[model samples]
Target: MTKILTTQNAQITTAAVEVKTLTISGKQVTLSVFRQLREEPLLTEDVTLNGVPWGYVNYHPDKCGNHRRHLHVVWQRGADLLRSTVYAPEVAKFQSVWAKLFIEAAIAEGLTKRSAESFGISKIQIWPHWATHPHLAEFSYGGVSFQAAIREDFADAYDNNYVSPYVKEKAVAITGPHGDAGSIAALKLPVAEYLAVWDALTALPHLFIAV
Candidate 1:
């Protein structure tokens, strides 16, 4: 099943200003916007298949052709890289040029069609497995509550006004409504391991039985 998920910064309420994300089962398509005071917000977009990188569109002022605005795409896994025509950084231009075409490209490239059953849901709602911290998402799965909190690796950078995308690492603990991490099995892993951990936790029902 295909699902579309979107999010915005905590202080922002308008949909026009929010980052848009689209997913088809475990596949992810991210459209990120950087707000600008004097022009259209710059955008970076990527499509990932089964948690692996696939295609992207971004602006690099130093690159040749169209002043560095173009789509960098991979047609299939283990396939050659393909570049599309240069595009404007505006959101509307991106939607017109890359959005539907990338979906077609992914289909032609043999992307998997995942079943809904392969995905799980938390008590609150269905959570996107690929989403990371700083998004303020909280959910429970396999009788364990999970919260996506900001990882500390980027703390100093954030304090100094520098930001890095490689900062998300999973830190998980099992607890009740008001329990702390002190009395639980707390551990940290990257996003891949975190998903595996939850799968294992949910599959092992015998371990959850009380003595």
Candidate 2:
């Protein structure tokens, strides 16, 4: 049997809610689904891992603040949380990405993969897992040095007061050999590729193991 819970929010109307229990890495977890109808219809899922509050999966119809209309998965890692946003056009892709992240996080946390597979969390490839790529350490192109010491700059604009819409408010500072620094938006990659590289480069060090 399926269980459903309903809640109300002042800004959005709750269309539906459903809760399900899932077993991951030998620990029981809860997955709560919320469908909201506002300016645009969106769905959110609150996840718990090993009885600890994990994170959330949110879907926005259009660009909302920093969140794109694409699927956004946010998960906890130690004291901080990491987010990965991907353009998933189909429901199957959404589910696959969600499950893939859950499994990866569980395994990174010293959990056994066999248990998760037994619980039906099969492996799926949605995006390039650059975290474990051997060439990642040597990757550089478009005059941007990714291997160099990367940092985040929260300033309003870069040199010459030039602000890029791609960088939004906060930007990742990548330095060049001539002591020049710029945001990842300077790479001039496509939106999807830019996000992929950004997520890979900014991911927490402990989340990935050497390949």
Candidate 3:
């Protein structure tokens, strides 16, 4: 017998693995929940612009490196790509809710098949954690304290949208420390509550382009 777990916005079917179904914009979409960490995407769909193949939208969970255990989206077009974090890594459940919001954001940005290049909007800022991080100076580890100059440099790079020429090298310089401080946790919300927030965000006119 297949067991069903119901949430406020989705139904998850449990078996050897879990699969969730959700209703977004009156359409049913399915998402898979992995029993173990997998390198592959949980879901993927093609994105087109003006009837031309623009790229693919990939939904990844527990991805490696910076995206570890985070439910996120990767917008890919050959070598060029952009990534968006839909939900924080610490919120381990409600993968389907995050996926739904990702799709909805894509739709709101007019990245759908029928949309043209002129219809594509700038990237959405779903949450603060998606873009910002705590300053590095607050933590010290391995007897290595981040110097004031280093902290100022990092702040400058961050202020410049992380595009400083020495940003990568500066980041590498601080990689040895393992500190327990300066961690910020994302707010965990129930499926329905998160959806409501997402709805309000999508309603902003600047997030969409008129084609």
Candidate 4:
């Protein structure tokens, strides 16, 4: 549709209407290079576009200009427009202060659109996979860094049988700081899910039974 085009600095001086996204680099943080902040579990902070508190950014073609365009994504915060312009002299500097607009940046710059939704935002400079993930939420519960993983998580393993034998055995193994992983939650399960687990476990013996 017909949309107003703005400069990467948020200025309305641009005559072209194609969509483009501006990126800023934020503090360096740990994360998977292949995923966005909403798709990786290694980041921990909040970044916004203009003023919108967005989990990620996206790009689209502009309708006002023949070949001219601007970024189409919004800030993660609530506002639709930025109060001030964000200036980045060097691409690397911008890459260090704000999260990179993955697929959108390329599209804005006339690149590939194969990964528009896969772009990333920064939480401590790294990409994450979900909104309520470790970075967005407080990592420490009582007094832990939240990266704690241990080996005892394997004790409660089971066979789901919903898929192939190997696939059914797939499970979660979250653990604490040391190898002394906490025991399985002894608490009761919801009626339906509990029954489901029981049924799956029941089939285990027979499937594994000696012939």
Ranking by TM-score: 2, 3, 1, 4
After superposition, candidate 2 runs with Cα above 4 Å error: 1-25, 33-68, 79-193, 198-211
Question: Which is better, 3 or 4, measured by lDDT?
Answer: 3
TM-scores, all models, native as reference: 0.15, 0.18, 0.17, 0.13
Writing each residue's lDDT as its tens digit, candidate 4 over 1-211 gives: 7776666535545586543223335422222211232222111222122233222222222232542221222223332222111211111112211122121111222221232223211211212325434221111111111121111211111111122322222221122222111121111112233233223322322111011
Which residue runs of candidate 3 sit more than 4 Å off their true CA positions?
1-18, 30-66, 73-211
**Comparing 1 and 2 on TM-score, the stronger one:** 2
lDDT, candidates in the order shown: 0.28, 0.29, 0.30, 0.22
lDDT of 1 at 150: 29
Q: What is the C-alpha RMSD of each candidate to the true structure, in Å?
A: 26.2, 22.1, 21.0, 25.0
lDDT for predicted candidate 3 compared with the true structure: 0.30
Could you give candidate 2's per-residue lDDT for residues 1-211 as a string of tens digits? Answer: 7645556423565788444322345544322212221121122221112121223343333444754234443444455333444332221132222222232222222223234343233332222235653211111223212221111121222112344544432221222322212222232212234334334433423221111
Per-model clash counts, in order, read 0, 0, 0, 35
Q: Which stretch of 10 consecutive residues in model 2 shows the poorest summed lDDT?
A: 147-156
Spell out the clash pairs found in candidate 2.
none
Query: Top TM-score: which candidate number?
Result: 2
The whole-model C-alpha lDDT of candidate 1 against the native structure comes to 0.28
Off by over 4 Å in 1: 1-156, 162-189, 207-211
Minimal lDDT window, size 10, model 3 = 179-188
